[model samples]
Target chain A: MAGIVEFEKHPADTLKVGKGFSLAKADPDATPGYSGNKADGEALLADLDGKLTALQEMLFAESRFGGRKRILLVLQAMDTAGKGGIVNHVMATMDPQGVQFKAFKAPTEEEKSYDFLWRIEKAVPAAGMVGIFDRSHYEDVLIHKVHNWVTPEELKRRYRAINEFERRQTDAGTTVIKVMLNISKDEQKARLLARLDDPAKHWKYSGGDLKERAFWQDYMDAYQAAFDETSKDHAPWYVVPANKKWYARIAVQQLVLAALSDLRLEWPKAEFDVPIERELVERS
Target chain B: MAGIVEFEKHPADTLKVGKGFSLAKADPDATPGYSGNKADGEALLADLDGKLTALQEMLFAESRFGGRKRILLVLQAMDTAGKGGIVNHVMATMDPQGVQFKAFKAPTEEEKSYDFLWRIEKAVPAAGMVGIFDRSHYEDVLIHKVHNWVTPEELKRRYRAINEFERRQTDAGTTVIKVMLNISKDEQKARLLARLDDPAKHWKYSGGDLKERAFWQDYMDAYQAAFDETSKDHAPWYVVPANKKWYARIAVQQLVLAALSDLRLEWPKAEFDVPIERELVERS
Candidate 1:
């Protein structure tokens, strides 16, 4: 808990790795929802942008050679947790060619009848593609627990199922990175209210949002249980402080780049067979 | 050609017609590459965001709904023409559940053997989903044309195929919005050069970038042909100015909102079927 506050209040430079990721401090002035040292966060984000571009180029290069490495980034969070802002700020700089995004919604009747992971399984990125999931299967734990949509026995079974699902994905060579955007309740309300007060933002708000707010404690309990149960070495969850969207986005980016770096992917050498002429080169 | 320039330079505020969209001008001085007059863009984006949210809610209102509507937005552009920025600034705010993104790459042998549209068809949004294509099948026209992938006769056939493909999509209730990010050649070179000069941006550049730059004239010729053949009333091209990334994003948002308004799509209704509980209101 102290680690969380320290990261929230101090610069990222001050962070020392603890058991897993060290939470960085949020910059108050960087952007309305952003948290981190403004200058440091900007620099870190810039670095991330460069790294992601390289990763993307490499992925595209891989595609050219028919090499496929599917990567999945799962962002699971409470509402008003800056998931949207995070996606905009962090993934904004990557080349579109190699990246894909999906936002998991409540299971439809058709989906509800199937296993929890069915819809999500279909969303995994194809070979040489990066897929970002905004609010994923963990919803079963977060929403289902709050709503009592299933028995504790069923929920317990799901934790094992999700673990197996992710492990299978890793075995299949799909790099899975999970992030939990953890913001406090007070901060969550402020954001929700912001959406309600602004007409332009009204579309993002709904009557049901308040209903979810009422179960804040229940959600926290559910999330804690989830992290305790499923934080594996392969697909570990980075507990991001959503109070500052900027720091969270940067943290996520750094984690992603770090993962891709581990893969040591290379760009494909172009095999251009197109007619080449001095005139075309100069004119092109 | 002047009409192209005129349309390119037009600010988003002037374009706000109906459907709660008001063109926004970003404040130029807020930060480098950060729009200052963002309030207006936010307003317009928020309007579209709300409309999209309403549409999704309508489609998924039923827990056991059988069918869903899908929308695909295709963005085709020259290098340094702000595709990434537009995706972040305009469409980034939409709920991820209702939206999907696919960035098509150079064709693999499998894709190359099939018709040009084969890979593109694989990425179209499912019903109730909004699919965004960053650089799509049009690449065969723009880049392939410049590189002479096929003879004039073959290229001509591709144009008709593209026009018909989008038409069939709209007839199937898929709202197809296409944008051609048109930037002056000088502007593009400036951007490319910026990438070269800035160490942080160097990774974004490649050797082929200059080669492609040399073929500017050829690309322009190809794009002109594409525009002439495919700019039908249903799926017209909005030739946006690319010099100002913020303005271009706003313009694209305006075009998207306009299409949604024309469809007169209604918001999904919330079906409250569970028994009312006193605690639910209290908790909320």
Candidate 2:
């Protein structure tokens, strides 16, 4: 509640994609949220931590008290664009009991047998949870389009399906916060090179990453098309400028806090006799 | 690795249910794994945090590098018996990306239409991940038995199905760590009363919790039967004493660390020519 006042005008308002939004025109390095240096951004993020923690706790408490609402944070980004960092730094602040984190890797043999959203549907946060999808159902549209894995007609059908699926989730008391960590190619190259230079980070580097980088232009086009098609009001896509890790982290944290605060959650009332319970405890 | 050496004789080995094991004989207040005070246990848990984090990172890295094995932690406990505490305190130390936490609630209309494990099968952690079931497939047997929701024959069938399902997971490279947080009735009453006394915690308290408490002995008998029927070498269940929150948290952490260490995980070797990649990075 304390930090909530400062975030009345969220950076996400500018970053959120609307009709006919051009990904080509969006600057990946733009810090639209908080204009500050690295140190200042870090301090702001540290301050937001307590507010986010309290909000998540209340959300969980509300769910337990028969409140039916939950939140789903769908994060779609290119490789090395800091999805892992967001999960580790931003989500790690909340009580793990209330946070469900799912990283959608390439479809497994069994998963491939079902529809793409089948695995996703199973991972949707239950009531009283905040679900984070590192990479999600959008991958089917993004990579599949880039690689020509699906016919264009099939891709269009999948897009419609995605919209309906998300619509259903929102109708059923789920707030969908979809984010795309938009990082420039140069930034990605730098991040990849850093991983290569550090032996400890070698485990995270894969030969396939370079292969994907070769098709970066195609992937970008795919992302642009997917965003244009699937950016609905209920599940609007916010393109977070991820070149600056601190700014990106703070922006996403603020977006989440703002979404939760919008819910107007409060602690549920005790239905039983509190005085009698307190007396019982004292007597015991 | 330092703590791994100390855990050669895991306390879970003693707490584990063997053939003809009786839950009635188990003391829920006993701290078997640790022989220390709360402060000492907290210190020990802090030390294990780094080791657990390291091991989990290796496991995740290995999975990305094509390691097929995973870890599944099945936690089953009564209300107010500290399941949420175990998830928040013990499991929260791991990287969120590498850990999947699923808390099973009462079956939905659709979920009830399928076999109990149908929904659970969808939530098993993928390779290189740690899957924690806050409550799990075991619930069908535990609660259904207490409430007579299933016929005796159906209960027998469900027990068999659970064994076969877990066996399949193990065959597919998942190590199952099942635990029952054993808490005394008095401890549970005290916890419930604490929730009632605190306005902030009122949301977590429900009248149904009291109704369930009235059937405490029946629930205990149901759990005992479940343990006798489902406890196997591949998916053994450890009963962690839950009266002292610190001890329960530490004990579960030790059990998980020991299970992971047994896998002998390591940082995966890079497939590409590292020198060449390093050269390319420098040039770029």
Off by over 4 Å in 2: A1-9, A17-47, A63-68, A95-97, A105-128, A137-174, A198-203, A215-235, A271-284, B1-10, B18-26, B33-36, B108-123, B144-168, B225-230, B279-284
lDDT of 1 at B10: 37
Residues B33-123, candidate 1, lDDT per residue (tens digit)?
Answer: 2243545444545455556555544443321244444567788877778887777657655655456777787789999899999998888
lDDT: worst 10-residue window of model 1 chain A: A1-10
Q: Which TM-score values does chain B get in all models?
A: 0.77, 0.96
- lDDT minimum window of 10 residues, candidate 1 chain B: B21-30
In candidate 1, the second chain superimposes onto the true chain B with a TM-score of: 0.77
Tens digits of per-residue lDDT, candidate 2, A1-284, equal 23322433577688888988888888888877455677777778888888898889999988876888899999988889998888877888788888887778888999999988999999999998999998999999988999899998999999999999999999999999999999988888899888977766889887678778878899889988888899999989998889988878988998898889989999878777888766654454
Against the reference, the lDDT scores of all candidates come to 0.66, 0.86
DockQ of each: 0.14, 0.38
Question: RMSD in angstroms, all models?
Answer: 9.5, 4.7
Q: What is the lDDT of residue A272 in candidate 1?
A: 36
